[model samples]
Target: MIKRLCFWLRADRLGPDIPITHLMLYFPALMRMICSKRFNGFGEGSEFRPGAYADNCSSITIGKNVAVRPGTMLFAEKGDGVPGRIIIEDDVLLGPGIHFYCPNHSYKDASRPIPEQGYFYKGDIVVRRGAWIGAKSVILSGVEIGEHAVVGAGSIVTKSVEPFTVVAGNPARLIKRLR
Candidate 1:
């Protein structure tokens, strides 16, 4: 019900502060919004499935036929400064618990303590067209998953995955190239 209200609020069809109970009372309309791929957010023909978690700070630009599965979290840096943009090209499929982080904590300065460094470094995260990220995958900042690549489940992607390749495990070593 909260999701539906959020969608409606984004679409500007309904104002905020509309009681959740009332939205739930109109269950049919709520179902229509949830089931339909066209509502809220900036993505053409992209589907963020129910239970998918996206942060408000995140700026998501998606192309056609993109599917972000349930339990996936997309986080972007916040504040007055511009964070990073998350660009998911067409026909991308993201599985459950896939986390795309756009910001990294600064650890370069020897003089500054970790917590005292305070500044967040950001870099754009791009998942090119037709990439499939499997469940429990973690994609860090400044990395691009090339077109048609497949990331195996539980992989931690800290670097770029070449086009048409399949990668797995921590640090995501390339397992094979897809023909």
Candidate 2:
């Protein structure tokens, strides 16, 4: 069991895997130790709970005092050799089942299979300071969620949200302004 645990503890191997999930739950400090170097920025006072999945963490920068709940997935796609950045600023609140996807698969060619075509990455996903993202929200590529903004549950954010605003629904229309 020690050997198996050691294998999963490697920097590149940590993710939504069950063993890692248990480790993060039972020994969060251990998870922090491994992730501190792997992530571009894993801030102080931040918590990545059990069942939170991330790929290309080297491209992810998380700020101070952020709370990422269970079932959240952070996929930071790399273009060329440089990874596409996913920046989550300080004091942010992410609810369960939130998914941040930075890569969009290309399907321009109708003749060829989509998988064979290739993939393209959008720009960085920036979640500014003090924002609250509700459960099951999907923040797509090239989107900027402004400071102190609130995203309602199950919202699919396609465009950049303005500061202090509340957005919801499939296309994530502006519901109200908080500021």
- Model 1 vs. true fold: TM: 0.72
Q: What is the C-alpha lDDT of each candidate?
A: 0.70, 0.84
Q: Least accurate stretch of 10 residues (summed lDDT) in model 2?
A: 9-18
Candidate 2, residues 1-179: lDDT per residue as tens digits?
A: 88776766654534567476567667879767656876889999887787788777788988999877888998887443446779999999998999998877789999999878777776889999999999999998899999999999999999999999999999999999996
User: Which residue runs does candidate 1 get wrong by more than 4 Å?
Assistant: 1-45, 78-81, 109-113, 119-122
Please give the range of 10 consecutive residues that has the lowest summed lDDT in model 1: 12-21
What value of lDDT does candidate 1 attain over all alpha carbons? 0.70
lDDT of 1 at 17: 35
Best by TM-score: 2
Report how far off residue 151 is in candidate 2 (Å).
Answer: 1.0
